[model samples]
Target: MFNKHGTWPMKSSLLTRNVIILSMVSFFTDVASEMLYPVMPIYLSSIGFSVLLIGILEGVAEATAGLSKGYFGKLSDNQGKRLPFVQLGYALSAISKPLLVAYVFPLWVFFARTLERLGKGLRTGARDALLSDEATAATKGRVFGFHRAMDTLGAVVGPLLALLYLAFRPEDYKMLFLLAFLPGILAIGFTFLIREKKKERPGFISKTKFFDFFRYLKESPSNYRKLLVPLLIFTVFNSSDVFLLLKLKESGLGDTLVIGMYVFFNLVYALFAYPMGSFADKWGMKRIFVFGLLVFGGVYLGMAFAEQIWVFAVLFLFYGLFSAATEGVAKAWITNISHAKDTATAIGTYTAFQSIGTLMASSLAGLIWYSLGPEYMFIISGIAALLIGLYLYFSKL
Candidate 1:
């Protein structure tokens, strides 16, 4: 006999009720978000936004989300609640989707984009903590990995849908934004099915400063700090995926081909995320993460020289592998070393810093690309990532 809760026939320990529901929610949400992702640059360009402006917009939006992650993560811990934050966050994001096309002004576009990210900031910590609560340290890698796979699976479907729509509708970007809202609404509805165990309040009750999560570093285990430092450094070099898409477009690929490539990359990521997570559990997470960094370095360096369509295909394939290895594995490593009570706070704080680094990274990459060239930007980032990977590989953590 099988469990009645809709778990798979395989190990129930790794795929619990909450994990399944949350993954579904992420699946729907990504479908909504990614539907617009590949075409966003082209759309913005159509509307007169330059690469520099796009970079700044993304940096500011991400910084807003990052700053809030720390605060909201702390608030979730302080309140000993997760479901409310999750519900509200998804709802906000759902509403923000259609707002992208509600108006066409730059300010409105920026507002809509940042609002969606703000919703992401609000939910990330509490949601991941819920996932963390459902698994023990031994299963953390697989648990997080499975969630990522489900999430990226949405990335796969979203772009393909966009690809198909654009095939007939070509440059019909506004309608796509409206269509994306439907999946976001679906994501919000799924969140209603999620339930969370009541978390115990943290031992200390501190003042609610906006940047207070930064204080967590001093109080966290030494290993947490050790692990976070290199990760943050790497983030400073890793810009938004928009850059990659833009590069493909700049290389003279048609809109359909560019979107198709994104779909292909995400498909690879979805396929490999779960298996890589299991591998991370068996081999050390640190080792897997370092390997991912090496792959990432190679891909970026390769991207610099990639002009042919086939070369771009190979680079995207490796890019997907890099994502599969790193994203969930990094969170699992953080959660493993963190105290249970502070799980949301720990992940939130780290992600918050990562977002800040993203701002810097994207902005700098944009400036570099504008001043020098895409090749220089890629080479600098690739070399930096390789050096950081070497440092992490040799580190005691």
Candidate 2:
């Protein structure tokens, strides 16, 4: 059932305990996070914030989270502990949900978004490192894929819940925000229950700087550094999903239908995530990743030119395929090249640069959308992705 590494043990004979628990935690957390996430752009629009402002808000929030991922990643290495950072991060996010309901200003929403992302940044690196710690080289793809599938499954549930609540309450965004608190707390409690095994660590990290995400990269192999080029390029083309969802609403789908589309996207994501990961293991991650980038291009292009609402069901599924292929697979690829001691830092640095790309993309998309509309934004992003995906394939990254 496991690889030869004898690592990242399955708690039972069936699967790893850490994976199962972490998946559960992610499920509950996503359930909470996605419940409010899709609505965020809509909420901002309702509060008289311009599309440009929404783009800026998304960019800033993600950039902040990216910073946290990098910093806390190194901190986790120095402390040789992952659980505490995860716990603290979850606590910060868990408390911030209700505050959104209580305070309803753009500035308050911005603060709430940033505060919640701060928690995510802190938790993400340490948590991923912990996961990598549990994983073995033999099944890293499946392991990470399983985690993503569970996480996306929660995303599916969250949007569905939001859709149902909205169906009845009909724009009761406050109640939806308040109900999110339950799952967030539940996810946090599950974090405490995780039992991490002490593994051998390279003590050399403590002597290095705390915030240096790129420190390990200099020391990493040339192939590792080269692979980063295309990843960053593609990320720069990929802006906020908030804009994409907003695009759907702008296409004349009601707010409720837009949420339904999100739920549908997550469902496809949950379904494909594990299988795609396993496929990557057998077929090869680079091929899958390259294919995913192309799929991203197709999805974006389809959304850009979509003439009917029926097209959404298909394009959104393509979006799910792209997400399943890239996210866990990319992490698995990085983990494969990285030294055991510095997984968190490598992942964090990767995340940080990608977020930088996201910040730029969102900012640019906002400006483009403001002038030309969503169609042009998607067209530009799609063309860029297509070019980048071709480059990555040729580069063999």
Candidate 3:
């Protein structure tokens, strides 16, 4: 029997509780974070930071999270616990949200953004590990996809909430910051309901060498290499979302419309995420991932040439579709390639590469935007996407 909350009857599998709790956690935290995300670039610009500094700050914030994900994921595996790390990450993010309201200085904003990203890094690998542990192999894609749907559901609501807050309180950005804490606190409260599982340690102690993880990955006879190379190539063109917002601003959209476009993207993401995952399960993850990459390339191309408000909005929606198809499914693919015992480590490694990709993409896009124009940034990204497609077509996964 299912509960009113739509949760299925609790069973021995990790799918039910872990997905439920993590989804709730993500939904609430996103409500808090998205409240500020759409407006952040404008806020920074208002406070006298140039586009270059904003790019640096955004890149640094994301890279910081990427850098920590593997380390914290490994730590969680070593310690054999997921809930504690998840809890800690959520709390830190919650605390950081309110800090934005209290401080107006640029450095403070940086610290707060970094803190939030750190929280994300700390929780990501462990969270994926937990989801994998709980799910049966056959249903792993569905489980993760559901979690992504839930997470995107939060993303969808967050912008709407931010829009409402801004509607009534146009002059007070701090209030939105303060209001973000509500969803975060709720997410934290629900986390205590999740049960932790015990991990079995191998008889021989694994060496803690810096490259030890990659060595294991190399030794494994899995299709990981097949997926990793293509995915990494696709990531090279996938710059930060800040560029999208900046593009919208450049096109003369108001802050309200820009945030509304973000809401539209998240709405599409939330709607299609689960179906996309289910589709992948029925077909194959590799095909879906590649298709999404191609779509993403097209979206970027559209953004490069778009001038009308409606055209830009349509591109954002397609961008959402691309994200929904790939993000959670990539994690599911990683789980397919790695052993259960090394789930966190494998996820950490993949996430690290993804972060490195973001760092490179964002930094390069920023330089392009500053030096040439926004159009060049998209053109370069488009070429990278096309190259990734060609590479993946020939590569075995």
Clashes of each: 0, 4, 1
Local error of candidate 1 at 395, Å?
1.2
Question: How many clashes show up in model 2?
Answer: 4
**What lDDT would each prediction earn against the true structure?**
0.90, 0.82, 0.79
Give the candidates in order of lDDT, highest first.
1, 2, 3
State every prediction's TM-score relative to the real structure. Answer: 0.93, 0.89, 0.89
Compared with the true structure, model 3 gives a TM-score of 0.89
Q: Which model is ahead, 1 or 3, in terms of lDDT?
A: 1
Candidate 1 TM-score, true structure as reference: 0.93
Please provide, for model 3 over 206-296, each residue's C-alpha lDDT reduced to its tens digit, 9 standing for 90 to 100.
Answer: 5455444465457555687667777876776788887998899998999778877878888898888887877777787777777787888
Worst 10 residues of 2 by lDDT: 5-14
lDDT for 115 (candidate 1): 92
Model 2 Cα lDDT, one tens digit per residue, 350-377: 8978888888887788889899988898
Clashing pairs in 3: 14-134
Best by TM-score: 1
* Whole-model lDDT, model 3: 0.79
Better of 2 and 3 by lDDT: 2
Q: For residues 238-289, could you state the per-residue lDDT of candidate 1 as single tens digits?
A: 9878789889999999977887898899999999998898999999899999
